[model samples]
Target chain A: MKAPGYIFAEALRNLIKKRATVLYPYREVEKIHLPDGFRGKIEFDRPKCIGCQMCFRVCPAKAIEIIEDERGKRPIFLIYRCIYCGQCAEVCPTKAITLGKVFENVALRKEELEVR
Target chain B: MSFEIPIGPQHPIHVEPLMLKLKVEGELIVDVDIDVSYIHRGIEKALELRSYPQGLFLAERICGICNCAHSLCYCLNIEQLLGKEAPPRAKYLRVIVEELSRVHSHLLWLGHYFHTLGFETLFMYFWRDRERVMDMLELMTGNRVTTSYNVIGGVRRDITPEIDSKLRRMIEHLRERMKYYEAAIRSEPSLLGRLQGVGLLKPEDAIRLGTVGPHLRASGVKHDVRLDDPYSGHEEIPFNVITYDTCDCYGRVMVRIGEVFESLDMIAYALDHLPSGEYRLKMPPFFKAPVGESLSRVEAPRGELIHYSISDGGTNPFRYRVRTPTLANLASVAAMLKSRGDYEVYIADVPAILGGIDPCICCTARVIITDEGKKTRRITTLTELERYARERGVRM
Candidate 1:
């Protein structure tokens, strides 16, 4: 039973089968599969945020910054610094912050990545 | 002449920045010295600066492949410090995620191992299957790699019925694929030729040299953190500890493959017998831990991962130490690489030997300054390192 190239059959069989990987960028966006509750880009709601500084304190990466304005206090998220652990969303009392499925959050500039 | 050949710091064979100084007579390796001081990020010092909740995220980044284990161990350590334990349901949920991650890690290792051994076909096959487990992780924990699922006191998320069914389906698919892979591995002559009778380490040597996880299990030693300590409600879950007596690279491969099956079963069992209660406990985010020290151990896919922390009744830990399994297993690698009388190690066999332990060099990297002139070696703390740099007329 100790034959050489024993895995060749499975390898050949795989050639006939559908390709496992999705052509994410090259093909249609629908080809890529993102599961439900996939932690990706951070989405912040200004009005819903209570400005308890809860997200700032609990953020391990210090990705969230509190800015005081006429609308009381709101958090500006530095998305590049975010680890995407969804801790801010989990700790948000008003359900203001949520991790959206838009995983392709790359940007040319640092400012573009920030969510206020 | 026995020539000294340097393998890495950056080499094709090493996956990470690991330098192996090999003394070789022709192709036979006479002696070896391993250097893993390349990528020390000073995570322990960083943990000391962060609060318990924040430290959990930092801990998860310690090892990407074993992030679940790292976060779980950190959570367990902090929970112990806070004099609290996760509820029954949370514990079971933790076990499910832990085992799932274990399966994923083992599969990744198996694929990477074959790739190192120059078996690309099996490598592709293994990784193709690993995507299933990754998808399941995403489904259950909201993220794929850095799940960050385990927080202090309890887990971050609860499993839904849909996820539970998907998990069971993944388990079934993996089991079938694993069975085929196991048979293929056993029957394939080329893989067996590379693995068998290579990287030989006796059971006694495995223990004396402090090898852990599947590497130790492959040496016919029954030392598992899950089996021995039973943290995170592992005591309730019934699973067999797989061991192989070959004490070679073959045994190591077999032990990991066996562990994948065991992990699948454990996940299945955990899901079936999951208790119904509060998954997460209500706790203030920015609270101080009591003045005490707590140590936690988890059976990470690589080996036994140890996390120790000391609290000075502050928002952050006074001191934090992490003993990654790769660090413990590196000693055994040095032992295995040397050429014995009948047991010879060749330059060709280096990859087989090194990959057997599933070396995660970044996880194992720690800074130790050895003053050669003074003949003294000491581990420098972050403060001491800064002070030493200043004293040496080096600007920060």
Candidate 2:
């Protein structure tokens, strides 16, 4: 017959084994990186944007607005309310609203953050 | 036939209004049903309607207690869409505010819990302690609960030397209080008597039901969202993850009681190693989100708050969804309630139970009332009781 002592030892091993609550992400956070198709911060191609107001109409939070220019269309943006959900870039026929890898930092004043 | 009593639709117990329909057989609760959803902001639906930058601000408004968490996660989702990151200095500021908010929230819950326990003296003491933490928050973010102090690139405000000193002092006072709690738990047999093994949720049940925050940690599980998903330079910050083995109400208190100290150590770490830089970066309100989807999780005062957003390459999100921690913890409450077969004994020390899981009722999506027939009771408020006491010629 198999040894009863071995069964007890196995039970002890399983109890501790089932209780491993340690998150291993700490050891590998450095190795992790976003895949190629990942999207993030919004970037604008000023030349391609036609000031059509399509992006503004498509904006859910009304964060997008048009600027007044003597010669052509204006592009304006407010940073304070932006959630960066990435809807503007996809709807742009000219691909003016592209997602860039630029991360903005905090500002002292609200007006300083508005980009046009 | 015994009647049922509905105690909500407008009640003082929860941060949000939750209606509780209790079937009672002569003051004994026979059956209970819960109904929520009075304040459903439809954040997910709203997310589908706004631009990326606008979504961040609105997301923060979802819960006043953890506005920073919702804002942080929303920013991360945008960053994921834009494929960018926040600078190191901004990251440190985020961590500082995050820990500060944790302290403020826990202090508030602690005070409320004491009020429920009929220990008004303890409640006053805890709230007095909370004022110190709130001072730190106001100094840093200009507002206490609605701290709209973060942006996509980094944090909106910076901490100066004076503010940092105030923070250190607050943490110092809190350390003394935390030590007292430890002593109280050790000596006050009544505390342990009421808490120990009162709501025993086996370890397996905790994990299976997806409990988060102190509720899960109380079960001897050391899972913290900051540790699991290190955002805002959390990977670099050094702090201990506290856990308990009791898996009962006492276990929950013990875990939270230990967290007060942990927050202090983290504040010290963040302050000493404070990164030097510009506080906020520039991101426009009319920014475009790339065509993508992302999910971000933050360790809020309650537990892990998860936000998921899908963008269709426009200024607005196609969908925005949030999974609050309390929602997850609610799943396990029935398990504990049924274990004792008595809500009166289990919930008699109301404040202690209320503080167990940090609740922000404002964000709950659904509240259901389960009862066979309609019944009603005119519950008297404390305000009314005091009036009665004075009129009856009773002297205190």
Q: In order, what DockQ does each candidate have?
A: 0.78, 0.03
Per-residue alpha-carbon lDDT of candidate 2 for residues A1-116, written as tens digits (9 for 90 to 100)? 23223224434654666432224446654443332223445667777877777777656567787877764876677767665545576457798877554444378998777766
Give the lDDT of residue B67 in candidate 2.
Answer: 84
Locate the minimum summed-lDDT window of 10 residues in model 2 chain A: A1-10
Q: Which digits, one per residue and each the tens of the lDDT, describe model 1 over residues B1-396?
A: 999999999998888999899999999999998889889798888888888888888999998999999999999999999899999999999999999899999999999999999999989999999999999999888888989899888887888899999999999999999999999999998888999999999999999999999999999999899989999888899999999999999999999999999999999999899999899899897898889999999999999999999889999999999999999999999999998899999999999999999999998776689889999977667799889898999743
Q: Provide the lowest-lDDT 10-residue window in model 1 chain B.
A: B377-386
Q: Of the candidates shown, which would achieve the greatest lDDT relative to the real structure?
A: 1
After TM-score superposition, the amount by which residue B316's alpha carbon in candidate 2 deviates from its true location, in angstroms, is 1.1
